[model samples]
Target: MLANPATALELDHVSRHFDGRAVLSDISLSIPAGKITCLLGQSGCGKSTLLRIISGVDRPDPGGRVLVGGTEVAGPGRFVEPEDRRIGFMFQDYALFPHLSVADNLAFGLRHLSRPERRERVAKVVERIGLGHLLDRYPHSLSGGEQQRVALARALAPRPSILLMDEPFSNLDQGLRERVRRETVDILRETGTTAIMVTHDPQEALAVGDMIVLMRAGRIEQVGTPFEIYDRPCSAYAAEFMGPCNRLTGLWSQGRIETPIGAFRADLDMPDGALALACIRPQALSIGPDGQGISARVMAKTFTGESEQIDIMVHPLAQTLRMHSHVRIPMGIGDKVSLQLNGAQVHVFPEEPGTDDPLDQS
Candidate 1:
């Protein structure tokens, strides 16, 4: 696997519609050469649809063009057929031929190469993926993770410039998913094979991709590195969807916000006397016994060892505020407690104009 700095991918105004409904709208982004980008969203968010269009399995209408290595492979009324596009795709279900042996499956797309070259490539990728001993076994005899690796080896064996994975690790258990995800990224980096993958798991996207693009209703909501997107989300949806966040509605004051919990200064400037919604990561909060901070009652508790989540019912306001604590607080349900914001910065968004539900349009 050779690194090619010349292989860059770009999508320009990509729009796809089906049966009078738009699946993707005006999507545009360029993937850095030799970098892995993940399309992240829940089911039906159009991530998979966009991946298909890029793979040339599905074509989009005018303005949708997938360029690989700076060459247009798909565009208005034109599409290079899937095989001709030279883009490798790993299906969600593994898609390994049931009757084909692991070695045969890995060699399926290498028909265009010399016999010796194909064998060498298959042997190398199979060994790299740790499927060396099962090369003669059929797909039915392999476990879910092994099957996934087989699919990956087959895709990589073709030496495609870009690899498109559709929830490739969805079938694996949680522990297996973590191990395989890390291994997969390491292999991709070692090979320097640029990739674009679709997954709903934010953790997976963060772990596997060098950059993550959050998609909603076929449109890109935000694009950034995992830490940037998680720490500084651009929207309420991104904040909540990416991880556990405590979103609170409050009135913004001069460089501060007054919420049910209490008033806290923010680093990001906000207009005074404006309605705003503040987002605080769970790990940013601290909890203790009733004290000078805003008063609340512990409604529920869940211990996560490193941190325990304390759900509290705030007084007067009656809003529930959940805070995180590192200690094993013995507070049970209905116990009085108080919480405080332990940080100097929080992310806030202008309250949406009508309905309180931020996802009304979604």
Candidate 2:
């Protein structure tokens, strides 16, 4: 864990509600300075609500504390207005003023500065965002990517201490989104700005963020680096949500887990005959002849030039297990293939209540 004592933003037991419905529930996390943190979750998971609270666009319950630069911004009947919080927000819709030209939009928040200072700030931001040529153009005349840059430039025009982004890349196409997000990350790092972005795209969160936060329901499930989360997920939900994983229910037997696929060893403490769930990454799987391992029929295959997605039917054990391989194996539908499970360590989770007993081998 990268622990920095100099945190730029801190949320202590934050919670929010909308018309009696809870949106954020007891959220707590500290965002370190000069680091990019991505809040990742599905729609309506309260990641955006947390962002709003941090930006002071929305207030948290009186029991929670919102701190920035070691000062309390919101706590126990106290609230700081959004504009006074020294936080910049990049909305999902870009939020560029339709009537204002790019230059004026970028200069909107600079009323406190002299005309020369405003011109200098806007010029610097426009040049950095690569929108120098489109400064005089209206929002309708600019491309999506250009408008996104303008919005970013406007937020950055005032040199905020913290920056918040709400799905800023969702408006762009897949390829363009990747490119723009990469550029935005580079800019943020170059400026050494502390930022927290809300996004549902796991890949984008992993690719762009220094730290990834996984959220479920209205609370944070886990937080770690991309490599840490991908390789050693804290739970089955975290593993499955971050990417594809084969979850198989099994029983612990003699230092190995006995599943329908076969007995496999794992570095976990499970008593003999204990019911457990094993999560295996697709990349860790290899297939050959079924006679050597657990027999599984080839369910389906989809080739994507670089890799092939092979779905094998591990009957009575799981609905199906999907695996990816670089080489195209010479097999057809209904063919049986042996399974080989190879990885550093597999995550074994305890079975939840009311689930079928994994020890029942009937």
Candidate 3:
């Protein structure tokens, strides 16, 4: 088995510019060793650029530094080549040589070793990754999942101190993607490999990452564990990016925000009359029989296999409110229903200028 120790990574004021436009802005982050860190954001958000910088495939602008295992690899005065950084990168397309057999691909990076040592290393990695049976197969003959496994094995065969994956499972089908993702995570944990993955999928990051770094417009939006990022997002943009949210405008009064649904407890340093915005997830609203909670009329329902999305028109609110429930909601259009809010999932933020007014969809 590969025995290289996992390496911790650090980025100090890492910024990148293309054509004089800032693509990465003063990014400073510390990624712990032997843990999976996900750089998550939409396309053009600079996540892939950051990954490239870390792998030494791209350079950061001046005044920026990249370090691995506490040793500087890239900075103003010094730079390390990609090959010399001891890093392995798994591309989104699983870039395997078409003409090379699986075994040869695994041995490609072992050219520094003698013939016997190269064979021994390939044998060990093949055995560890359970690809011995397919050693003679070419890349075109392998299935997508099989090719992914081969790519992973090839990357790990080098026993890199750090591994980088760029949307590594995007090409697989949904079912296959989940299965391969699980397997990939298991292998990384078993090997104690420090890995950084760049992906735009929030669910993927939440499912696999030990730490999630959310980015937007070339800036880090939030960095936290999955639960922390999902449940306690630092900004409204961060909150909505993680999942669907119902935005409600309200008045902040005496440690709570009073909205059309009802008063919700929120500890914010705002004046009593300050305008506040409440973000509630669809799952946080519970539908019950009339007279139990805030009365509303069911306006629409959408069946999504595992769950039902119910849209209700609260009496005092101009726009309909949406809630999700796993159980079937029996209410038809115009049927009276009650909506109860779960305080834990309701997040309040100070309303800013130009923020959308929930009631004004015109």
Candidate 4:
């Protein structure tokens, strides 16, 4: 078993480059012990590269440092091989040995143990995963879900200091993927092992991560709990990444934003007349009384399984505001509806210089 350290991982000024291009800028993160942290971002966003560096499969540039359990693993004039770091990695592909049985594969990392000790460790893990009956089976004979469990079992068999997973459940069908994900998170929490997972799916990150590290363009965008990241994104880009949103362009003044739809209260410290985005999440709009809310003409309506997506054009504003609202309304195209924004919180981001409005390109 790995030693219990107060801090599981820390990165100090970590950066990576390739062929004169910087793939990861100076990124530093402190991960807590026995917690699940998710590194989430779109493609080419440097999430996977960061994971590789953490696992010692990729090295950071000079002057960068990586520490595991408060021990310096990588730094100037110091290096730790991937195997010496005591990190367990579950690659994008399972990377299981087709020629080896489940038991042998689980026992692969226990070479230092005696034969009896190896068997005992493997048995304990296999039974913990409820797969003892399949221990003698080969990888090819198992289903994808079963194979995933076996890979997890093998990674934990040696009980490394940290575990890294890259798109671990993307290979399975959606239904099976959710089930496996729930079970995997349960096991991780139960074992109290520090773990990090890389994923592009925001919902998946929210569902499984204790803390979320959102990245973009080779930099950290936001770091917080799932609730904090989703409920209070710091920027328009960060807000859009979490889910669909309806953005309104308006002038900020006196803690309120004046828009064509209506004057809504906003919390911002920007000077008066500064441009900003009033981000309304899809679920924030509710159908209000006909005479008391913003007037809109329905342009389109899409029926998603659980709720309806109603596209509206808010007239009488400085510009025609295209808005999307996910709500239940038995209305059709050309229908006139009133919408009132209601949420526990409202998000407003100051517009950047030289940046176009979010809806301008829509």
lDDT by residue for model 1 (1-40), tens? 2323555777889998999899999999888767789999
Which stretches of model 2 miss by more than 4 angstroms?
A: 1-5, 254-256, 264-271, 289-293, 315-318, 353-362
lDDT of 3 by residue, 1-362 (tens): 22223548889999999999999999999888899999998878899999999999999999999988888899989899999999999999999999999999999998998999999988987887789889999999999999999999989988998999999999999999999999999999999999999988888999999999999879999999999999999877778778888989899999999998888887688999999989899999988899999888899999999999999998778889899999888889889988898888988888877743222213
State each model's CA lDDT, in order.
Answer: 0.82, 0.85, 0.90, 0.84
- Show the lowest summed lDDT stretch of 10 residues, model 2: 353-362
Task: Supply candidate 3's per-residue lDDT for 103.
Answer: 90
- How does each model score on TM-score? 0.91, 0.91, 0.94, 0.92
Residue 40 in model 4: lDDT = 91
Tens-digit lDDT track of model 4 for 18-64: 99889999999899889999999888889999999998989999999
- Please report, as a residue range, the 10-residue window in candidate 3 with the lowest summed lDDT: 353-362
Q: Residues 1-362, candidate 2, lDDT per residue (tens digit)?
A: 23345799889999998898888899999898989999998777889889888988888977999988888889997899998999999999999999999889999999989999999998888777788789789999988888888888899999999999999999999888888888899999988998899988888898988899888778888999999987878777787778877877888887777777666776677788898788788887888976887677898999999999999887685488888999878988789988777755466676565643222223
Segments in model 1 whose C-alpha atoms lie over 4 Å from true places: 1-7, 264-272, 353-362
Predictions: Cα RMSD each: 3.2, 4.6, 3.8, 3.2
Off by over 4 Å in 4: 1-4, 316-327, 343-345, 353-362
Q: Order the numbered candidates by lDDT, best leading.
A: 3, 2, 4, 1
How does model 3 score by TM-score?
A: 0.94
- Return the top candidate by lDDT: 3
3 against 4, candidate with superior TM-score: 3
